[model samples]
Target: MTTSTTPAVKSSEDIVGQKYDRCLADLLVKAGVGFGAGIVASVVLFRRRTWPVALATGFGAGAAYADCDRAFNPARIPGVRVLEKKD
Candidate 1:
């Protein structure tokens, strides 16, 4: 009896789609955290709350976080090179 082994191969489209999905999910999580923080801050600072202000703050925070993440974690951002230190 012989066992047949087949290797799994991923197409370019599938790989790109997966990467896109992961990036989107990461952004969503970051945005959610920012939104929650903005809401909490708004509540603490003012007796009244507004959706526009909260949303603006949330998006700003999310963008900032994404930028920082990409800058610090080069592995996450494709084509970005990380410099290594020489001993």
Candidate 2:
């Protein structure tokens, strides 16, 4: 008698969830960096007196970074095209 071994495969939902988690983590890091940058810039340029403006600027920067990052990332599966024969 022989025993068979098979690897466990992840479901589509699980795979998608993992991808979403990674994207969320990346966005969080980007937001933190943007906030820090805004704080530094505000202090250096405005003598640390523009709290409201700095907060808004940081939020906008973070959102823009996330949008661009999502747009530029390529899909896991590449597209395939079939060639036509010449008549």
TM-score of every candidate: 0.54, 0.53
Stretches off by above 4 angstroms in model 1 are 1-4, 49-87
Q: Write the per-residue lDDT of candidate 1 for residues 1-87, one digit (tens) a residue.
A: 998889879998887677667767766777777677777767787654777456855686568567666644668797867679999
TM-score of 2: 0.53
**Residue 85 local lDDT, model 2:** 96
RMSD of 2: 6.7
Q: Looking at model 1, which ten-residue stretch has the lowest summed lDDT? A: 64-73
**Model 2 stretches astray by more than 4 angstroms:** 1-5, 49-87
Candidate 2 lDDT over residue span 39-84, tens digit each: 7877788778677455856686677566655544554225844458
Worst 10 residues of 2 by lDDT: 69-78
Summed backbone clashes in each candidate are: 0, 0
Residue pairs in clash, model 2 = none
lDDT of every predicted structure (CA atoms) = 0.70, 0.67
